[model samples]
Target: MAYTVGEMARRLGVPASTIRYYDKEGLLPFVGRSSGGIRVFTEKDFEWLRIIECLKKTGMSLKDIREYIELAMQGDETIARRLALFRKQRTVLETRMAELQQTMDTLDYKCWFYETAAAHGSTEGISDLPDEALPEALRPVRERLRAAAEAETEEV
Candidate 1:
């Protein structure tokens, strides 16, 4: 089915301006114009927009997204290049997810430590837990947790 730009944007939960921006950036290859120069979109447009949203969410820059779209418009000639680009993006996102997971794990551990220590009324109990008890990557979290715990004790 065909849809106006505003209708499509509403359905997608994105700003109409963003849709216009995508068109202006040449990311929408089949975008059409209405009689009064307004934008007209089809179901395929919405589908493509969803793909664009996914790419953007996966951390692709607009320039790269446009390049990908340009290559996509070329059909099968660039399929390998597109696959390679997406693979590279996937690796990046995976690395980011790993780092974020480590940070979240560290934060969870700190929260648990603070809760437990507070219940016992002493941050000193955590002193001998060893500097490298957790990942070296967690050292920063440990320091932040220690400082926060100390500050809380002082406030008490």
Candidate 2:
């Protein structure tokens, strides 16, 4: 069944203005108009919106997204291009995830370090604690952070 722009926005969990903006930006080329010029959406349109949302979440700019959508509208001949775009996006996400994981690991080590210091009532000897004294999971994180700090100091 068809849906009004408001209904589509509600179903997609976005504001109607966002849908209107997408249309205005040429991202919703497949959307139709009612007799009164109101935007009309269908189930197929939801699939397009979902793709747009996915790409947006992947840090795709509006211009890039519009290009992707245009390529998609061109059908089978653009399959290879689309696949390349997706693969590039996947690589970008993987790199970002790895960086975020490293950051999280560093934060975990900091939390443990501070907790240990608090327990001992001072940080005087915390830095000198042996790796064996750290939780097994955090030992590597601490080592990596220490190495990074040392590298920075050497660079200075």
The candidate scoring highest on lDDT is 2
Global CA lDDT computed for model 1: 0.84
Q: Each prediction's Cα lDDT score? A: 0.84, 0.91
lDDT of 1 by residue, 1-156 (tens): 779878999999999999988988888878888888877898888888999999999898899889888888889999999998899889989998998986797777777667757977987866567766555766677787678899999999
Q: Which ranges in model 2 have alpha carbons more than 4 Å from their true place?
A: none
Residue pairs with backbone overlap in model 1: none
- lDDT of each residue in 33-90, candidate 2, tens digit only: 8999988899999999989988888887798889889999999999999888888888
RMSD (CA, Å), candidate 1 to true, equals: 6.5
Error of 1 at 84 (Å): 0.9
lDDT of 2: 0.91
Over 4 Å off, model 1: 129-156
Provide TM-scores for the models.
0.78, 0.90
Candidate 2 Cα RMSD after full superposition onto the native fold (Å) = 1.6
